[model samples]
Target: MNIGVIKETKTDETRVALQPFQVKVLIANGHKIYVENNAGVLAGFPDDEYVVNGAEIKDKKYILDKCKLILKIKAPLDNEYNDYTKDHIIFTYLHFDENILPDKIRELIKSGFMGIAYEWVEESGRYPLLEPMSKLTGYLFAQKAVEFCTKYKGIICGKHEDYLKGANVLIIGLGTIGLSSLKFCMDNNLKISVLDKNLATVNIRINERFKTNKIDYIEKYSIELISFNNSDPLKTKAELEKTINKYDIILNCAVRRPDMPKDKLEYLIDRQMIQTMEPYSVICDTTACDNDLIETCVSSEEVDKIDIINDVVHYSCDHLPSIVGKSATELLTSQTFPFILEIANKGISEAVKSNKALYRGVVCYKNKITHRYIAEKKGFQFYKLSDLV
Candidate 1:
């Protein structure tokens, strides 16, 4: 397979999909890698190093056209989308459900290319390529949330700016992303309130014997800190509204695709609207499909919510791992090394069969999209992997 690596075109994207050392591993497995010049520059993997590691140093356009498989940190922006082909297998944290997928992405899916999403590929409960960045995004979201909260008045900060001492912060969701935010938020010694839709999960948190309690109080106090499930949106919204008014910051760690409840949520949002809560109120979501967050950043000639919430910031809807530069690259290597080997030596078919990979097209060879989320979005069903087998 002619594996290709391209410099990410998504604004603020400093991470590369393939690091030099990782490329060398694939190369040793009889796979050819074509990397764009300076592809890994932001990640500290210079073009010279790629050449030294036996990767072909090619231009962006050249590799995209010729490679059998492609690795990208972000969905292609407009310009790059026009040149995308149909035969390449594109791999990355594709936020397709968010509808933030660029037009180029639609073209790639329609072109019948093999698309593998790192975020969806879970192995032994770990998201292979996306774990590192997800962890970073969760941590970074808290830091940025603190910055955004300063716009509001009277957020409990002890001594300096960035030090959030005694503030009410709510992180909804206890997944990888949520826990990550909780770690940073707790480290800052802030009062936290968390929520998830799982009742069983609620028991796990409040259950004093939840283990790991000796080390972290956030886990200990989570039970007592006021948590709720999504059983009742109106009541939940009211409870959340009260907390939002009381807290200094709100970090939305939930990973829900925001398409299903437009009217209901809009109505609830209106009911819970608390503009009088000062201008410094910060709301940050590390969730991928931040449609509401994106909606918060717009305006129009006729009607707009432009000035609705001030000082509120959405975690860079773009990939945040890229912002940390080389650290992001090192993290990418940690993620891609295993997957690259599986693809090079064993083939994508085997990888997907192992339930450790997510595929794009020809899901069942029954002519239907196979991935559950994609199928849900496109109104298709999960065809049997065995049918393809």
Candidate 2:
């Protein structure tokens, strides 16, 4: 098996799909590993390190032309589209549902390469490959919340005895990202409240954590659980309005599928709700999609530049993990290397057929759309992998 690690071409994307250590492991397993020159440089892994670890350093053209299995931190850019062949198996974060261009999607279909999306690779209903990055994003969101509050509003985000009250934070989801943000907020002595589409699941997680004596902060501070109707955005907005103004920071980690209808995709926090909030309040959307849960979050912004709508600061960076390339790449490779090894050893056809997680990750296989969600959203014909395999 020949595996190629391509340098990420996305702007501000510094993480590499494989580190030097992983490359060494792959080579030891009797697989040929080709790394693009400076592929891992931004992630603190140099070309010399890869060379020392038995990886052949090659240019992008050589890698794409010779390697059948391609690994990347991001999807192939427009310039790289023409380089792909039907035999190529690209494993990366191919976010087809999110603001991807129609032409790019069509190009992928036309190329007939198998696209195994890292974010969709699931085990026991959890996204193992995506979890590390999500946790990193949560930490970044919390840090940004503190910075925005202090810089824009001239108020400390954390609680202090001298102050009458600490900053109030509303976490809009209780998934991996939300829980991580909650842990950080608790450590910082911020008043925290949480809400999720499934309150029952949220209660179970809280109760389980409390029983294990893991979350002592929950005992010290009353963590309120707010509920809202996910089906009706207007009603949810109305419910939030009663107390939305009181919150100093709002971290929206909730997810909205791209295939959802426009009517069902109304903003959880509309402009009218933003007008009710205090000046300089921070709203960080961890999901980071345009016209997502936060109405004011028109588009993803750079970490340094934030959008100000109705005096509230909106922080939404789509690739927060990229900013912390070293840690993010290390954590990402730990989970992804195993899957890559599986595909390398067993081959794509055998690997996808044998590994359900890998099969689920396949958005495109055998020149057809294997993922129903993406196919339906893009108005393309859907083909099941089982039928094609």
lDDT digits (tens) for residues 80-128 of candidate 2: 7788888899999998977786667888658788899998998899899
Model 1, residue 73: displacement in angstroms? 1.1
- Scored by TM-score, the top model is 2
Candidate 2 TM-score, true structure as reference:
0.92
Q: Please give the RMSD of candidate 2 to the true structure.
A: 2.3
Lowest lDDT 10-residue stretch of candidate 2? 209-218
Give me the overall lDDT of model 1.
0.62
**Distance from true location, Cα of 303 in model 1, Å:** 26
Give the residue spans of candidate 1 off by over 4 A. Answer: 101-105, 151-165, 198-224, 257-272, 291-316, 350-368, 380-389
